[model samples]
Target: MHYIYLHGFASSPRSTKARDLSDRFAALDISLSIPDLNQNDFSHLTLSRQIQQVEALFPPAPAPVTLIGSSFGGLTAAWLGERHLQVDRLVLLAPAFGFLAHWLPRLGDQVEQWQTDGYLPVYHYSEAKELPLHYAFVADAAQYQEESIARSLPTLVLHGRHDDVIPLQASLDFARTRPWIKLVELDSDHALTDVSTEIWQAIQSFCAL
Candidate 1:
């Protein structure tokens, strides 16, 4: 199976988890591919566009792909696994379902301001700059009803109990209906840094070759 890891929004393949996974994969003599989702301008970033970017990485009729996606990327993987039959397994870290529900409340009146301005300036840690995300992002994301997407693949979801970005309840709600999904709660926050070793072990055991 081919392995690929999708990093969170405003993050890159250089993230701590990405680097750690790469090193672990090397030790296991495996190749783990990580693509840059935000290679284009943030103004052009949307769920549809990001999904298309991931689609472009496939080698024609190649080995089955096992996906590891974090945050927004985790949501991306969830969508892809539903649509693509070649996806064998999924490991999601703080997958962002019902994310706008959480974000909109935080943005509050800024939602109206962003729609009026056409874009919102969000700080991108990797770029060290505030990037412009078009209001189209919110609209595009709304197109995909999270619960409607199919998720029959072998899946594991790791969510931080203290995650301030996306709520732990989102995963709990889904896992309740879909008992096949293994949801592991971590003591860490959205970063999931505190339980890195445990998460790594789970990944290794889940996709053991």
Candidate 2:
């Protein structure tokens, strides 16, 4: 069995959540693979490419793999679970569904400026730099706009009520639509701050699946 943790947008696998989870999973004798979704070019990141990269990481076998995705990575994991049959379970932390919609609005008038300028400056949490996101990123996400996870796998969603970025409602709507997906509301923000133990335990229990 493979244990993988997918990080969020602008965030890397070396994040506190990813490292702590990796350590906990290590103690359980489970190998966790947390790949950098940005790859080589943070300036031109796309979800589709990350999806393919993650798919390629797994060998051509029928081994069950559990996915632990955070924010943007959660969205990527959901896409993977929808396509691949080997994903046994999912543990999402504030997934960014309808991300384009949220992002465009957040940018407001800058959307036009970004489209005209061809790039938008955004902070990269992992790199600790204000990286420029190409306009192509938004266009790429549109390809999967109508796509959603219809699979009924054992899923656990941890969201924050104070999360203004992704909004807790998104997770609620997802869990509401799919009975198999369980949503947990935390008091923290979109970061799911100070909930490492809870997240680890949830992942471990879900790994038992």
| TM-score of model number 2 | 0.95
Per-residue lDDT, model 1, residue 82, is 88
Location of the lowest summed lDDT over 10 successive residues in candidate 2: 200-209
**Per-candidate clashes, comma-separated:** 0, 0
Per-residue lDDT of 1-209 in model 1, one digit per residue for the tens? 88989999888888989999889899999999999888767666888988888887865675689899999999999998888888889999999988788888888899999999999998887888898889999999989998787667799999999999998999899778886699999898998877889899999888885
lDDT of 2 by residue, 1-209 (tens): 78788999998878888888878878877788999888968889888888998999875679888888999999999988988999988888999988887778877899999989999999998888899989998888889953466888988899988998999988887778788988888878888858777776776676663
**Model 1 bad stretches (over 4 Å):** none
TM-score of every candidate relative to the true structure? 0.96, 0.95
- Clash pairs, candidate 2, are none
Q: What lDDT score belongs to each candidate, Candidate 1 first?
A: 0.88, 0.85
